[model samples]
Target chain A: MDAAIRFHGVGKSFKKKRVLDNISFSIPKGEVYGILGENGAGKSTMLKMMANLCLPDQGGIEVLGQKPSWELYQKIAYLSDRAKWYSDYTVEEALQYGKNFYPDFQMDRAEELVEFFKLDRRLLGKEMSKGQEARLQFLLCFSRDVELMLLDEPFSGIDLITREKMIELIIESIMERKLTLVITTHEIDEVEGLLNRVSFVKDTKIVVEGEVEELRLKSGSLKELYREVYA
Target chain B: METRVVGSYRFILDFSQPIYEQLVQQFRQMLAKGEIELGSKLPSVRDFAVQMKINPSTVVRAYQELERDGLCEKRRGQGTFITSSADQVAGLRREMAENALESFVEVLKILGVTQEEAQKMIAGVEWK
Candidate 1:
């Protein structure tokens, strides 16, 4: 498989707290990978580095075989739990803004997703409910025809029904476009079925990474293994 | 038939065979024993993941295998369901058991156990 992203001896820190320590992993093209960790496990920080929102304090990071830069921004779509949008902008306006930034943005898909999530195009971002905002964020990120997508807590704080819908949407998008996705979530069970591979982060580093079934066969159960390793 | 409510559908399946093959065998057992009723809702990937504390992705793969084998049907937004007919399950079980037996014999032979000795040992073990 082609390499979509690579990290080499990557380390990041905020003040005295180290977020990622000597992290190294390679994600293959056209694969849905899950990054699993508890709170404060460096998943978000690592994802930020991959998105080039934050530079690694040490080592190197690459996406689609190149270092992330403003020129490569269009090739990557990043969604996080704290997706910030102009509060006064309407749903349509948000889509328009996204298209301005990402040349490959799919306007039709964005419109379809807006309708799918039942978000009113006229409604301002600030007026939307939390779930609706989340749906909007997801729609915008997914509507971009990018090579790599980094989703941070995409399902967090959503109701079960919406969460399921979001998961289905993500799966369908990946299948339709063959986009490489890296999702970070604490709710492993929710997204576990959708991932091709899983990587566990602990002590500011990736401690486990491999195909999901192979890990299950070796450890009996992933939950058991997680407790054993991180307990 | 009394439906035994298994708290979670997620199974931490352990067998000498591969994960997908092991899942197929377990589904067969569930069918043969009538533990899973026809058209009954199998555990959702999330529910199963929580039950087994495994990734939902593994459950999805197993469920996909079941669908491919015509042992289950997936309903969008709903959970997977067991096929109504028992014939398919029975046929698959027979084929799987044959393969499993062959593997067992091969391992025993590798361990230098004679057929007679293996049979004797099998006879000595009590089936619960």
Candidate 2:
């Protein structure tokens, strides 16, 4: 049981406002881990630290058994909460960008996903709806053969059908490969079945963290636990 | 028979309980009731995971429990299959019946019903 990501007493601050305080946890390889919390509870900050998108003010973070580096970035796919595509690029061009930039990107899988998600190749990024944009972003990230995937608020502002499709793709990816996924989302019930483990962050620290099934057996459903912890 | 086998396993999972335990219980009950045909191949771990929309590890756990209980066997390079032995099936059926009766009696005790009253109720039931 090797760890795919580890955070040791990590802390972060933005303009003197402390967001995360002394966070510590580790996600095992091939496990689907969820970082659950309300908005601005430092869930996204933890994901950013793993992706090397932000620097921690204290302590250290390790990914794939090493410090996060440019070389390691190639092995990790980080999908941001605010994913913005090149407005001028067509759907086909957007996928081509992923192929050219990510050496691990599979064109065949991308093409298959494009059809599965029902995206029009000729449609421009600016012309697509919110749900369609989310689909495109997810497919782009999912087409890569990365070892660790960091998804921040993947289901926010998306339609129900699109969210279900994303969940299906997540399960399929887990089955097909040895992938460790770290996702932050408010929609806990939707991904409850997919998460092997979860950590609930509140007031800049993890209030609860353990195997989802064990926690559920002791307390209740994750949704009920979420209410008890955050409500 | 193939359709029946596939149709019987469409489980609407309840997350309040341990998911793997629920899967194991369902399979155990189905095997005891002769619902699942012996020698039929179960879905592969990967396929079952996708079909059930659950983690593959959960499916593996349930399948391992089934194998350990002698209700199923996994052949190398082949999928898991239900036990073809009538003796094993009969054993499971008897064990399941005993478990059910024990639970019923326990509930009756909790309700403060005497054994004589329980026997009378059982006798009053109309068997199909």
Second chain alone, TM-score for each candidate: 0.61, 0.88
- Runs in model 1 deviating more than 4 A are B1-19, B26-93, B96-128
Best by lDDT: 2
CA lDDT of each candidate?
Answer: 0.77, 0.88
Which regions of candidate 2 fall more than 4 Å away from where they truly are? B1-8, B107-117
Candidate 1 CAPRI classification by DockQ: incorrect
Q: Looking at model 1, what is the TM-score of chain A?
A: 0.94
Q: Candidate 2 has which clashing residue pairs, if any? A: none
Q: Would you list the clashing residue pairs of candidate 1?
A: A192-B56, A192-B57, A193-B56, A193-B57, A223-B53
Best-fitting candidate, measured by DockQ?
A: 2
Q: Can you list each candidate's DockQ?
A: 0.13, 0.65
Scanning candidate 2 chain A in windows of ten residues, the lowest lDDT window is A80-89
Give me candidate 2's interface root-mean-square deviation.
1.2
Which candidate number maximizes TM-score? Answer: 2
